[model samples]
Target: MKLKLIAPYLTLIFAFLIISCSSDSSNETPVDPKAANNKSLGTAARDFLSAEAFTGLHVEIAYVNGFKPSATTINNLRNFFSARLNKPDGITITETVVPATTVGSLSREEYVKIEKDNRTVFNAGDELAVWIFFADQNSESDEGNSRILGTAYLNTSCIIFEKTLKDFSNRIGGANLTLLESITTQHEFGHLFGLVNLGTAMVTPHEDEQPDDAGVDKLNKHCNQEDCLMYFQTVGNAVGGVMNSLPTFDEFCLADLQANGGK
Candidate 1:
């Protein structure tokens, strides 16, 4: 089915600036928390790609009661990670079922707190933990026809607007629901890997120029290739002119990952 969208559930990357933590006792900041999993997006690209720092990758899937993703969606994500990451130890994932939420929209700070309260993984020892929250609510940042489907907000954190994506995909008889979920999830992870100059530097300058929005994030973040997985548009993940399955990252995005130590 062709997905007709009024406002496409677009992927958002906040190139969030690394927040400076407060001083400790002797005017020295603590090293652990500063470089912890809560840092800005894409800052830990090498840690995720190469096994130099973190040999094992653990993914924490936390979702609201009614919004847990299907097994197919999770498996697609695993396959996507296996193709790029050099985690010989392996990439593991687990699901956490949280209570259903009532909020109509989620805020950035609210998302951070959700992870902080329930996240059990972190950048510790030899494993780097990633937390993906499947939120039942849309983002408070959504304006009119511009809704955010998934976001790469922090280095190790991502939020998927399950409600928005579900509606966008098949609410009015659109594309396959599973494909949309897989694509949105993988796209968010792309930002975590620093695609398009977010954290992973480009081997060639292929950043897509967006003139529609004036925000800092609307510039220098997405791929110039419209059909690439990291493309700024929602149709980037569609196949054969439809949203049928997840699309692999374009060559340039793949090159960026390799240069940054990915497989």
Candidate 2:
């Protein structure tokens, strides 16, 4: 009888532990919706472009007329951004190439022109105009390969990417540039929406030592730990040594989005 009673007690204890573990697991943080949203955006935008909704967005492509990039290069750049953003089918994105000689290094007047162009490109609809520039005039080394630039605004109807033929040429026949374009454009757009930073604004000397370079690609961030995308990891090199795959922002970026009600 005593043995039988002990057996029942053991079973009850086991069941209670299982319930407790399940409760703890369920209490963990929720997952991000972007992975799903990105897939959906891609499909929806592609379908929209294929259907009758194409011309209404008034998307037009124009180069500075004397710009260095061939028409085809400009087209390639536009297509890349459109596909990445999952642009709606009815909307049109115009790619305009500004001549390096005409708008060499963004000037005050040039900036004003670009800003006005931005308003025109985006219009009241989802229309966009992408402008490319080679060098900012403020930088010393053009070979630091930093020409990849653009801005995406929230209230505005357009986006801009300033690139030079030389910078474009260097990225030819590689996925890095493509990845960089998509990541930068998407990230900037997120910023226009008032998304806050995630994680530490800067990497600490200690965390810098933890980068995947020494084959420690995985990091064990504790609960309550926050990382912001603006954080710069100064110590360790990127996992693939490619800036595209590097964390332009930390994983906590996604987390912050979730906390702030971003889809």
Q: What are the models' TM-scores?
A: 0.83, 0.38
For candidate 1, give the lDDT.
0.71
Candidate 2, after superposition: displacement of residue 97 in Å? 5.3
How well does candidate 1 match the true structure in TM-score terms?
0.83
The lDDT for every candidate, in the order shown, is 0.71, 0.30
Off by over 4 Å in 1: 1-35, 213-218, 235-241
The number of residue pairs in model 1 that clash at the backbone is 0
Q: Point out where model 2 deviates above 4 Å.
A: 1-92, 96-103, 117-119, 122-161, 164-175, 197-240, 243-251, 258-261
* Residue-level lDDT tens digits of model 2 in 166-220: 2332442323443433433334333332222212221232222223436764332
Q: Residues 1-263, candidate 1, lDDT per residue (tens digit)?
A: 01112353444532211100110112212224435875766788888899899898999999988788989999988988888999999988978876666566877667666777777777768998998999888877666655567777777877888887776566444567678788778877887888768779999989876454344433547778866877755443341134465677888998999999998
